[model samples]
Every structure is written in C-alpha cells, then in structure tokens.
Target chain A: MENESFYDFGGPEPEPARPSIGRLSTVVANPTATGVEAVIEECAALSRSLDGILALIVATSDGMLIHSTWSEVEGMRAAAISAAALGLGQRIASDFGQGEFHDSVVSTGDRVIGIYAVGDRHVLGVVAAAEDVTLGLLHLSARRTAQAIGRVLSDS
Target chain B: MSEIDVINFKLVVTGPFAAGKTTFIGAVSEIPVVTTETGTSEGREVKDHTTVSMDFGKVSVADESQLIELYLFGTPGQSRFDFMWDILSKGMLGYVLLVDATRPETWTDAAAIKAKFDELGDVPLVVGVNRGTESDVDKVVAALRLDEAVPVLACEATDKESVKQVLITLLINVVEQLEATVKGSI
Candidate 1:
C-alpha cells in the first residue's frame, strides 16, 4: 500500500514533465547542419509564399533566434518580445479557464504581428502589412507555416 | 485628502539565473504566480526551464491604517532578457536582489545586475542571500560592493517566514527613504 498523507487527500496528481527539445543548443552548436538548414528553409519558403508578410522569425521558446528574414539585431529583439507575448497569452488563457492557447495577434495602423506556437518548444513571429493582409488570411497562412515548421523540428 | 484605503507597491525580485527568484515570490504571494518559463538551452545542465519574460505575484498587508498591496515581479536573470528588466523596473517602489550563497561565481553576475538596477532608479534595495547563513551576509555585501546603507540578510527562499522577513526589512527601508524625501522638501 502506498503511504498517503492527509494533505494529499483528493488532490489531482501532477502531470509528467515534458522533455526539453534542446533546440537552442542544437542550432548554436552546429548552425550549418542539415536540421538547422531545414528550419531556415521553412522560414524562407513561408516568407516567399506570402506577399504581404514583411518578415518571418523562428525562435526558441527562450527567445533565441533560430532564423529570421529581418536583420540580426531586429530579429533578436522581436524574438524576445515574441517569447514574452507567448508566455503572457498562455497564462491568460489558463487563468480564465480558456482552452489551450493557439496564437496571438497585435494590430497597429500600418502593420500586424502574429505570434504562433511551433510545437511545445519554439515560437514563430510573422509581421505583415495591415493594409494588404486580412486577419483571416494571415492566420491561415501563419498557422500552416507553423505546423510545417513544427514537423521539421520534431523530425530533427 | 481622505485616508487612503489601499496602497499598491511594485517590488522587483531579481538576481542571477537559478537564484530562487520564482520560489521566493511563490512563497510569499497570495495569488497564483504568472510565470513565463521556457526550456533553457544554454543552462540546461543547471536547470531545465528558465523565466524568459517575467514572473508576477501579489500579496496584501493590511493594518489599522491602510491596506498595502505588494505586487512582486521577478525578472529573467539572463542578459538577453535584460530588456524585460528595464520594462519591469519602471515605477517600481524598490527591489530585492537575491543571490545564491552556494555559487559565488554568480556573485559577479549579481554585482553587474546590481549596477544596472542602480542606474535604473534611486529606489531602495535589499539584498537577500538565499540558502545562506547569517555569516554569508558580510561576504555577499563585500562581493557585491554594496553600500553600507543597503540591508543584506540571509534567507531561505522556500520558507514563508524567512521570505516575509526579507520583504519587511525592505519595506522598512522604503519607509525610511520616503521619510527622508518628505523632510528634504520642507
């Protein structure tokens, strides 16, 4: 028989921990490797497929930029902001009893930024021209790209 | 003006990576903490997940005079997230710089962080040495090159009572600073 404490009465058991993807180390350790190249190619393909999209950035959950169409400094800053926004979105969803968080969109007068989860370990940020892109089209395109990116990462 | 019913203060808890900032806030906060934890690639050997954005928690101290609400904000320790430090420190009443006693190497990082926060504001600061004894206070002060007025105290981040003491000590310092400012304006 298992020893149970009074304090443990009727409490839900904790979920098992998920394994870390170690994506940051893998990309940093060998940027030119096949797997890293595949992720970069995915970002490039996604950018080419969308006309209104201005930039596409793929970053680790911890805000390290894996690939981006933007310059290095701008990409790094966007990646950090993406991580913070993703974290805040997840927390708000959980707190309000909303279902699993999918994506978040920030719209301005001239531009829109969409942050989406790529699997459990990475985030994808898409910046687009608000005048040229509809919210629905941006969502559909970004969601598909995010899924493809997730597959590439999982296989890698 | 009528007696103030509620007063809110923003307090930041910051230090080097894995210095128990999250645990310290969770120990004292009345609400469920909002944490932006993500898998760490660089420091995976030390800890699996790290705070990429920030951690938020809240506690209230009610006395006969007024109700004080302390909003605790914990920052990501890595320099890459240093931008969050500035964003979080805006309008902060004061801050607590927690350092891990077991890892003296991180004290240098702690010192650098202290210097950054010092530039951010003239707010009061208290250094809490986690997993340390009373004897560690002196060493921490000397290593951090802290001012003589900064209170350095040993604390266990996991202990509620210990965490409370650290906050209370910082609150006392904050009060003293406010008093000094009011007197100076006269």
Candidate 2:
C-alpha cells in the first residue's frame, strides 16, 4: 500500500555534497583481489551518474557504522540508524517470509536516498535529486554496487 | 467454543489527517498504544530525514480459546509517505479506511487506498464514516460507493464501544471469508 504524499519532489536543492572525512572507513578507491574496491568506485560513479554524491556505509550486523562516503556535515549517524532499521525490517519480513530485503528508500522533495543490503554485513546508501532520479534507477545502481561491495566489506 | 488457532495478521487503518486513525487504534488495542513522532516523513512540506515515520498499533484478541495477534498500522496520509504504503500493504488482509464525514473530498483518499489494496489482491475493507461532529449519516454512506455487501458504518474514533463494534464487524467478515476458503480447499 503506497501513499504518494501530495507534495512535489522539489525544493531548494542541496549544495553538491562530496564525500568528506568521518568515521566512514574509506575503502581502496581501487579494489584488489576482492571486488570491494571496485564497489567503492561504483558508489562514487553512481553518485556522479545522478548529479549527486553517494554515501557507502558498511556496518556490523549489530547496527554500527563501519564505513561511508564520509560526508563533511552529515555523517555515518544516519546510515547507522538506517542500517539498524533495515535489519529490523528484514527480520520482521523474513519471519513472515518477504523477499531478501532489497533496500529502503526515504525521499521528500529536496532529496531522495536509498539503503541496500550488501550480503549480510553492510548497507549501501545513495542520495540523488528527487526530480532527477527514479527508484528503479537507484535500485539497479545500488544493487550493482552492493554485488561488488558485499564481497569485500569485512575484509578490511 | 471452537478451537481458535493463534494467527498473526497485518491490518492497516488509513484516512485523511485528523481522521482518527490513531484514536481508532488506541480504542481497540488491548495494550497502551506506543508512538514516536519522528522528523522524517513522506508527502509533507517538510522532507527532512530526521522527521518521524507513520503511526502504528497492535491488538491481541485472546478470548478464552481464540488468540489472534493483529498488527494495525496507521499510515501517514501526507503525500510523502505514499511510497511506503505499497510495501506496508503487502500481505495485509484488510484495510479500515477512516473517512471524515465532513470532508467529502476525503473520499478520494479512500479510492486511492482501494486501488492500491486491489494491487495486492481482493482485500476486504471496512469504511468507517467517522463523524467529526453530529452529522447526517446518510450523506457519508452515499458519498462512499460501497458495494452492496461491503461494510460501511458510522462511529466516533474516541468512543470505545463504537470502535469495538466496527472491529467486530471486520473480524466476522474475515472469518467468513476464511471459512469459504477452507471449504473450497476441502
């Protein structure tokens, strides 16, 4: 049951936010034998594709932020909370037999973001312009990134 | 009393703002309803991630032999939360669309709710024509194009007896549907 908030998905746009230093454990911009490095590159590229930046946060199954695109203003706190919620949601659904939790999307006109499950240990989060992107695109891009990122998330 | 098995079912109570979803849930729930106001939400003018999510309530029906655990989630009517509804409605059995009798246009939300529920499957609905004030009940019934069989009733969300009656009506309808399905399976 989906409700479309009668509001439009646009407002004063956010300044183009680039990943900054935070508790986010930045992975090798170029990955090695494991594909984790490649996934980080994809996360950066995915942000570039939507004319927005991405935040890739790895977390312990227990809801602690492991790594992120490391923003300057907003940090891993949001991702940590999101990962916790996603884990809870997945547990609730799986107890009832819903699909492998794909992702959670949170949007309001100014910006829209997604949280995805990469294997079992981490969530891949991305934010894009509300008007510029669609859920379909975000899901596809996030999954591709998760595929590579999930394999090597805990390696480092 | 027939042997009543314990079942976990999901149900949704939706309507326009101030239509009394929270009140209705409170009235029927056996436990004190717990809620949190978050900054993040959908369809509102404010789109901050910090805003809260929607409202929810739970009721346990333990009548001697029958123990049914029902989770009644109250969806935020504002447009932004619209995206969450699809995921919320999945696997739910019925919808209780609380309509404000005074706001005729609010029926539009009911239609939107019905269309979305239909996508999941044929869901039994209980359209509660919530009277904001003393109202001509007939007008509320006429505005809602309810099938001859669908249940439509007048009630006050804050009134305990009235709310329970509405729930009982729905429970009976669901049991009836299940009985039919069980018969067919035989």
Candidate 3:
C-alpha cells in the first residue's frame, strides 16, 4: 500500500537558483576506489559490449560530464538533461512514497533514453536505437553495467 | 583535435516580490529559459503571475581552448517562499541582489534578504538596481548601508546587455574571490 504520508512534506521544494550540492552528494556517493579513470575505462568497455547503444555518458549528479562516447556538445546536452531528470525522478518517488528511485527509461518509436544512478555521486545516461535492440535487452545489459558502475563509484 | 577545458559556475539573482527576477533571466538566456511561475492571489493588480520556484539561464564564455559555462538562476522573491533561497544559493560563486528602484517601500525587505544571503556565506555580491538611474543607485546604497566598494549598476531587467553586464560584474568578483582563496590557502 502506498503511504499517503508523503504529502506531509509541506510542499515541493523549488529548484535552487544554483545546482544542488546536497542533492548531488546524496545521489552520487564517493567511491572507495582511488582511480576514477579506471571507471571511465570500464564504461568504454561496457559501451563496446552492447550492440545497439549509440551513445553512453557518465556524468556527475550535478550535470558535469565526466566521460562520454559522443562529441562534446552531445555529451554536455545529455549530462544536463540527465541531471534534471534524475532530480525530478527522485523527488517524485519520495513525495509519492514510492521508496528510493532506482533508474528511469524513456522510450519512443525511434530510440530509448536510459538514466541510472551510480552509487551516490554519478549517473550513467545511455541512448540506444529501438531498431537494433529491445527495451528488455537494453535493460538487462544496462543493469549489469550499472551494477559494475555502481561498484566502481562505491569504491572510488 | 586538442581538448578544451570547460568550467561551470553558478550565479543567483534574488530580491523582494515583483522585482523582475524572471524578466532579467529571460532577457539574457540564450535558450528558452525554464521557469516555474504560478498564479498570484486575486486582486493583485501588479502581477497576475508570480514565480513560485525559480528561473534558469545559461551563458558560455569561450576563450581559445577554455570554455566557461555560466548558469544563471533567479529565485522566487516572496518572503513566504524564501526557504528556497538558501538551497539555490549554495555552491553559487556570486549573486546579484536586484532591487526595484521604483518601489522604495520594498527596499527594506530587499536589504533583509540580502543580509540573509550575506550571512549564508562569504561570496561576492553586487547590487542591481532595476528601473533606476545613477542617482537611484546612490539611494539604494544608502538604504542598504552597503560598503562604498560594493558595485552598483543601473539595471533594466528587459535589456539583455544590461543583464549581461550585471553577470559580468559578478563574474569578475567571483574570480577575485577565488584568487584570494587560493592565495590564502597557500
């Protein structure tokens, strides 16, 4: 049963005039690992393992692109959009008593957008073509990679 | 191709009600700004709508291989909705306290809000006086009892160049603060 007590939050807190450092820390945790470069390399390897993945990006929860398989402009755009989406998703889940938000997927006729939280301080955004892969396959493949990414972040 | 360093910084615009926070952001944002405005109370003739959340804009400064991405955020000016200000101002490098020169009555409230942010952190701040002249700027300085060194500029919220100038002024201060911080730490 959904708890109606979520409404007790008084009201929705507006987006801060600046990107939120607190929320960023909550969403992206510090990894135990010393080398974030190793994680970036892992992301590159993960991208290669998927046949349909067109673009893969790793970014800070605060919208800074850390690494990407796309060009600079595309990477920046994805990072910004992912940060906004993650913040809203987290709020909605909390407010509606949906428990902690895990990940989100947006599907259209042509492509799919996947956003997954990595540990606490990072987010992985993926763009894949519908023609080349099913959402089920994408999720399955992406979930395993998300776990690895989460571990990397958790340790870093 | 060579890689370029892209840095991101944040700046906030805040003040009392109907202080043109939304207008100022809309005037300068290169892309269609994101805003959260809700209907105002009935019989409020001055404004039918008021920003309940915030406004966001972006500007990019590119020099050679370095790119500085500046994000501008405008806060909801009502005292009742003041809780968001602290959240928004966090991690901000600097801010512009916009005051409506035409509304001298609102000056005290604006100063109070400014003082709150001033207490929040030691970031650089500038005063942007809207719908005011050079002389009105002096009045604002006096009302706020601001140090003579605080930068004050005549701001027209609808004028993009004026808004850009305000941002530039804040950016300069941010750089200076950063330099000072680095030097102190060393």
Top model number, DockQ? 3
Candidate 1 CAPRI classification by DockQ = incorrect
Question: What is candidate 2's CA lDDT for residue B70?
Answer: 65
Q: Per-prediction TM-score, please?
A: 0.57, 0.51, 0.65
The number of the candidate with the highest TM-score is: 3
TM-score of candidate 3 on Cα atoms, chains taken together: 0.65
Q: What's the ranking of the predictions by DockQ, best on top? A: 3, 1, 2
Per-candidate count of clashing residue pairs (backbone under 3 Å)? 0, 27, 14
**How far in Å is the alpha carbon of B105 misplaced in model 1?**
0.8
Give one digit per residue, the lDDT tens place, for model 2 in B4-60: 655545566777655677778878776444333455444344233221344445666
Candidate 3 per-residue lDDT over residues A61-105, each given as its tens digit? 655555666544445545555655665566556768678766889
Give the lDDT of residue B29 in candidate 3.
Answer: 77
What's the i-RMS of each model?
17.2, 16.0, 10.0
Residues forming the 10-long window of minimal summed lDDT in candidate 3 chain B:
B83-92
lDDT of 3: 0.71
Per-model DockQ against the true two-chain complex: 0.04, 0.03, 0.08
What C-alpha lDDT values do all the predictions have? 0.74, 0.58, 0.71
Model 1: per-residue Cα lDDT over B122-178, one tens digit each: 889999999998789889989988889899999999999999999988878876877
Candidate 3 deviant stretches above 4 angstroms: A1-156, B1-5, B62-65
